[model samples]
Target: MKNISKFIKIIKTLNFIPVLSVFAISSSCSNKINYNSSTDYENNQNFSDIDERDQVLNIIKKADFVKFDSEDINKIYDNFNYYTKGNASPYIKIKKSLQLFEKYWKIDKNSEPWVINILNKYDGPDITIDAINDEIIINKYDKNKTQEVNNYVEMFGDSIIINKKVCNFGYDKKIKTSEYGFKIISYENDILIPYYIFNTLFLSPNYINLYYDGTKYQLFEKIVNFDNKKFKNFFDCAFPGITPFKEIREDSYNSLKFLMNNYYGLNKYYEYTSWESILDKYRDAMLDINPDNYTGAYFNFFNSLNDLHSNIIIPSLFNYRIKYYQQSNKRKTYAKLDNQLKNRRSLILENSDQNTNFFGYLRNNLFISFDEFTQNMNVKGKDFELKNLFLSSILKLKNHKDVNNIIIDLSTNGGGDLSIMLWIAKLLSKDKEISFYNYNDLNESLIKSTLSESKFSTQYLSKDFIQAKNILKSKQVILLVSNNTFSAANLLTSIVKDYDLGLIIGAKTGGGMASIMPTVLADGTSVAISSNNLFLNKNRTQIEDGIEPDIKLPYDDFYDFRKMEQAINNFQKTK
Candidate 1:
């Protein structure tokens, strides 16, 4: 399950694509690719591919299996005797239960009506992964008294003997016991398959992935691991296309230095030009720096990007105060423009209470006012109430002869789940599927994505679309835009424009079409990277470039209802 914005508050709080469900439970995005929906594993024997390690494991399975079930536990212990014998496989499958979690970052830049925020998702509790191969004997037994995972160093030999290095007294600690566990993977609609993300955090899942292959489960892909050897553990791409920032493990000070060198880890492009100089100032003095100093340094680093889509987020539970830094003058100007727009919005909608409804009408202009992409809507999870609210509004406007024009106002909307986009699209067109594709730079394929998909996503979306068969067809649509319109919200405008559903009006949107994911530092600090690149087509040439209004409105006249009123009338006349 994948939603690249897995580790930051700025992107996290902005109600983004609810996917992979921490291995997310949410669903649906683009075209007819059946994609890896989570439900495929809703009943999976967890994340173990025992079939691949049969040669290495002497475990047993029941007809219906839960990886950590008591019977499964008993069988592993029953076979533990064999595992101890020389004849048994060389690996010790650590029979332990643990739950892993992935976090998210949100796009909170210095702008009006947009605040800095981060969202967190845990992979759930008491979840464990299985280590079935001799490779497990090689990879497991994290030393440091189980505090830190040690890296595997290959011994130069005819058969390539490998050994784990001694970092301190911790290296002496080892796993004497054997048992069973299971792996859980996260997938995203932005990405088709879950990529291997290997680090100290995950040394084994980095090596293999299991797939359905149309019929039965099989070893879909095998990835090679790379040794970062910075701290104690190795950093490698566990997920094929998405890898975490491994250099951060080298030194606490090296986090920004490493990321600046590889900013694409969470983004497609690097915006900072002073990287060499910035690194020169901060790289060598890491050991002496305080946490607040480190926080300031990272904050300044992100501030330099001047990118609304990206930011440096400190974990909320960790509750570290990020030392505030002043925004660049260029950033200040952008923020000012947004303030003006908000003021103008106030003047135009003065008569209407702004907070009550997500959709409404003012005179002949039917307005769909959606401000954010969070799941905490009228109701929770399914978005059923929000759907009905929007659908009902559209239906009412369609019947009202006075409503000859439509204004889909997404000015303050910061985008949440992709399904919400499709649900809105369902009301606009008869074509149910929001057909599109993406290119993952790491995977280098249009068909693949940064995260794995789940059946749950596909099934739920398919059902949601099916239920909304009739739409407000052929109505003249005019979309309102602003600089804050972003991510999935930005995508909504792009989709509407791509399908010729409407005319865009206002400023160009924030262009952050890439799906981003997080990687953690040795200190448990998390930073993110744009693990996947998104494109609008199979050729991978075009992407969801920020939307430019077909009819650009003047900045000063944003508050002037006459401008929008005239545009709506002019739009209707042309229709």
Candidate 2:
């Protein structure tokens, strides 16, 4: 069923224009045209009078019946059996099912112009196939309708052999697939329908099958149902000159609503309000089906949730319009604070290169600052390079005997790459094991481990334990955080506060501790939501509300190095 669905999705992109008009003119035009009845042959013309091409064309025009050689038909049957393991249907029964698809090739007045306009806009080439007298006639067309016809000698099970050149089906010529998966080649002017994909248009089911008999008729029935539904939906276009349909908008809305109800991590947090009422308010706006209304509804809904990791993406819009919903009040406060901090010239050392300036000494105190934790595994040795850079910084900090205070600044960091965050936590904490909690409605579990026990490709450095214990045991460690410190950064702050590893200063860290899960809706709208893996503190309390600072200071004062140093020293003295 999955393979059949994939096949249907591929065929939906094909340029299935009404080829009857092209065939009639390209063949014998002397034969009079009759639009009322398809079976009316002009003047009761005998088959022996015209050439082989004319006879095949006349048969297509009169009866809508496509003729194919016994061997060619057998090749289809053999491939079908091989792929389905002979479980679909017998050869005789499957042949009967093929007749149901002949009407799909017949001309329709309304669909022809719509399909052709889309094909022309996308620069998709037109193709026609005719099997006649043990050979196949193939016609290829450009956007201007310039046609070229060629006779193909042999047909493989999944491809056509033309002039000893094999054009394999089911695989894109430009975009090749590697062992890992599809590797994108280019996004422009690369629309070519493979033969196997066309075969699926006639063979596979396009809709869900409730009564699965494992027969070919069951599959054929689904294709017929889906085409009928799609044809009706074509008239429900949302905007003029735009191809998106109203049904697509409705489907997108319903699908996203379903996912939010079942899988979103913050469902319990919104228990104060009625979730159904909030969704009902947005439902009508989303279903209105215009571009502005649909996108606006999604934007408003996500903002109401106030989760930073959740958003909607419309790809057809220029540059792929993305809208994120976040805590409005918190963000507004942070924005004003950030502007003020930027204007002041603090005593902290500034460096343009983040990689080279992870750690530095500031008046007998060691400060480590990073915008984000990234492990670029796509680049050859990027992760290894980052690991070595961090190790060198840690070793330097460990050897500095004059350093008494360690300040980890994460004021503007938005967090990324969980494994890298854990690795850094292990290097800065004095304890041998770090502990946190993961909470879903179904279960709540504590996760405690050393860096060596990580499932990801992270290992403890050679002197990580020794260096961390030497510096952390005798000195005070402080964390500087702000509203922008979110996701994994937020989780790190919570861990520091929960385990008494450090003192937090500045404003509260922005809370976005859940892992993100992104999915594409039925209408091709991309949506991301916080997943069920919600982060929690050691007391089994939700960390989504953020962590408060132990020694809070104004944003402007926090930016001044002397003031921050004084606050840290005063807080340690009281302890």
Candidate 3:
């Protein structure tokens, strides 16, 4: 009977779920490619006049010679580690072995078809010999195969070489951020074979004869080679020394900016049809790269990665002004609306108008400084602290009068503590039981517990919910929101819409709506990933697209509030 009653209670709670919302957008830390027109390639005879050879020659001539230094090798290795995977336990052994090999390998000029060591197995496409032409020919496209080839005829006659070698770690061992460094492979067979293996891998490619001669070699564009031994060098040249993760991330952004400015012109890539308008001024730098080909190249690059957070930012110089203005406007608007918010504070209790002898109306400042309030408390799990503080203040003002109409000024709240949003809402609601569908990843092992595990389901917990639901039933709230209301704040706004709890009046909330996974590597370096999908309400509408507010109110419009206040005062007098 007890169990039955408990289940009934649970069912009831699920039915009356007070609009679950969160403005807090979580992000997975993204620690972060390609090529060209084929029609221009098939017509090689026309290309000779196109200075193709000379172009290659000039690139080689101007190409920066990157020496193999210990630091450079380490940087390359570091980068490789982030992308590749190795045995869970044997990574240390593998890295050590590769480092030793890289230290001994003698690097010099004229190492024909430069060979990168087979730190692991090369498993991409391989070449196939042709029968009719008495010459090698590689199949351009082959599905479910591990080999790629490029066959071309040079002045000397037929030439066959391998174009790409896709390598993988130990069988099904996923690549991680650390154990990705590689060792050099042999430069035999007219291909740079990094010691890796794929199916039917002994073969090479039959590609068109396109050579980068010594004169043109200097002008050839350079590419980064990653291995345990080359990571430090890559870091020093590309970014530089052990620095904060934020700084390293900025370097990646800058690198992308340079690529956009020099390689692909913006105007050609993202005109009215593309993201160029969104890019605004940065479009000019993008146009300078290759006005005609920039759009195609940028799109190709943007789609190269599957990670959601992987992206390209033009440059800080271009984005800085826009960001400054946005922030400045927000601050000014928040200040103007401060008094209106102050005037609407009310008591949280039921029918306590007579208690006015003890307490007056509450203050309107809805924003609380996290750093100041969390001084002594262990904030890690103190999700109820802020809302409880707000409720306690409201209760003190309950003077035996039923104060149902209220205003929550969320303009300055940057959003924190999801439970707090729910709790505060509960103070105004009358529902004894509020319910929401409990959704979660059953694979607990997939969840990284070091940062947050049980916390993800805090909203669904029974004990943590009742107070907030009760608050929502009786109070008709007008939440003053703005762009500053983010993450949990946004979630709160979403709840209002979904549950029909209240109305949101303000600018659009922040757009970050992804859930993140915080991880700490062996080196103590921490990073986050967006592993789980999140939703807004019980119906499970994914939150990444964000929740739309019921009413749109511009933060800059303060005069509009004076009229609203006057109307409310008149209604109060009539009552």
**Which one is best on lDDT?**
2
Q: Write the per-residue lDDT of candidate 1 for residues 72-117, one digit (tens) a residue.
A: 3212212111111111111221211111112111211231121111
All candidates: TM-score: 0.52, 0.53, 0.35
For all candidates in order, the CA lDDT equals 0.38, 0.43, 0.28
Rate residue 388 of model 3 by lDDT: 45
* Candidate 2 TM-score, true structure as reference: 0.53
By TM-score: ranked, best first: 2, 1, 3
On a 0 to 100 scale, what is the lDDT of residue 139 in model 1? 20
Query: What lDDT tens digits, residue by residue, belong to model 3 across residues 105-171?
Result: 2222332333222211222111222111222122222234433322121211112121222111111
Off by over 4 Å in 2: 1-242, 272-274, 315-358, 376-386, 442-461, 464-469
lDDT of 1 at 278: 63
By lDDT, the candidates rank as 2, 1, 3
Higher-ranked by lDDT: 1 or 2: 2
